[model samples]
Target: MPQDDPRDASLAVKFSPPQTWTAESVDGLATSGMFLAGIIMVTRNRILAWPSLILGVNSWINQHPLRTKEGGTPPVGNLALAFFALIASYLPLFLKATAEPAGATETQTPLSFST
Candidate 1:
């Protein structure tokens, strides 16, 4: 009878590729939480919230490694988060720029005052 080679078994185990990245389990939850928080902040018009939300998304994105199976790419969740954050953070500024002036000006006297 031929003896089984222990070295061969160990090599087989070592070389086998991992089915998935371990970070997905933790990062998925983290990304979801940040996305929810960003939505809330967007509704409230809090500009400060966008940066951290972006950071959380970036962390989740970095946790995954690009692979070559199942089309071999991570989803666009992070990119979407970034897009929404940018819109949320900048929309108010854009709207403010386009708004009508309040009619208050240093050069112009009050409406009650005559020239």
Candidate 2:
């Protein structure tokens, strides 16, 4: 065989055409996470916010930019929303002082007026 041309423009490795990415279960979870994050952000539910946060992180990790359109902010937005939801849910705990100390008893006395 003749020596290979050094200036050949052909790629050594063949790359298949990019196939459009279809949303599957992971995406569904991301969608549900976004929905739950919205609800959590609105309701400030601490219990449900944790799951939304977890799901948002998951979505961010699984995001595929080259395979889909509008790949810019979906994952980042989801994660941010979830983080905000978590913060919103837990922020009140830090805003006000506790009404009572743990295991403390409250004593009340009636006010008296003497004429």
Candidate 3:
């Protein structure tokens, strides 16, 4: 009996083609991306959040199965939810932009410990 080559097995595993994309896989990726965007929003960083927000919106628009095959009508609930999330994601940035600047204050004198 011929012995199996370890190197061959390792190469087979390493060079295997990636799995094909499916609706479920794409949905999971989109969900994860949206979750990351939400985290960035929490940090109040608009610059980073902007790209993430765009990604999230694109994912929703492209991946959502709102349209029906028979009647061709789109489901309103999911569409509404996507819009709501998109709006909510930008709310922090909007609020920050519209916030009033802090008033100027006089600096306090430093205390000396010399006795």
Q: Quote each prediction's TM-score.
A: 0.42, 0.65, 0.35
Structure candidate 1, residue pairs in collision: none
Clashing residue pairs, backbone N/CA/C < 3 A, model 3: none
lDDT at position 106, candidate 3:
60
Q: After superposition, how far is residue 95 of candidate 2 from its true place, in Å?
A: 0.4
Residue 51 error for model 1, in Å?
3.5
Tell me the lDDT of model 2 at 54.
Answer: 95
Cα error, residue 96 of model 2, in Å, equals 1.9
Q: Can you give the lDDT of residue 23 in candidate 3?
A: 20
Candidate 2 residue lDDT tens string, 15-112: 66645454322478889999999999788889999999999999899887665555445588899989999999999988978588887668867888
- Report every candidate's CA lDDT: 0.56, 0.81, 0.51
Better model by lDDT, 2 or 3? 2
lDDT of 2 at 36: 98
Q: Score residue 79 of candidate 1 by CA lDDT.
A: 52
Best by lDDT: 2
TM-score between model 3 and native: 0.35
Among these predictions, the greatest TM-score belongs to 2
Candidate 3, residue 18: CA error in Å? 20
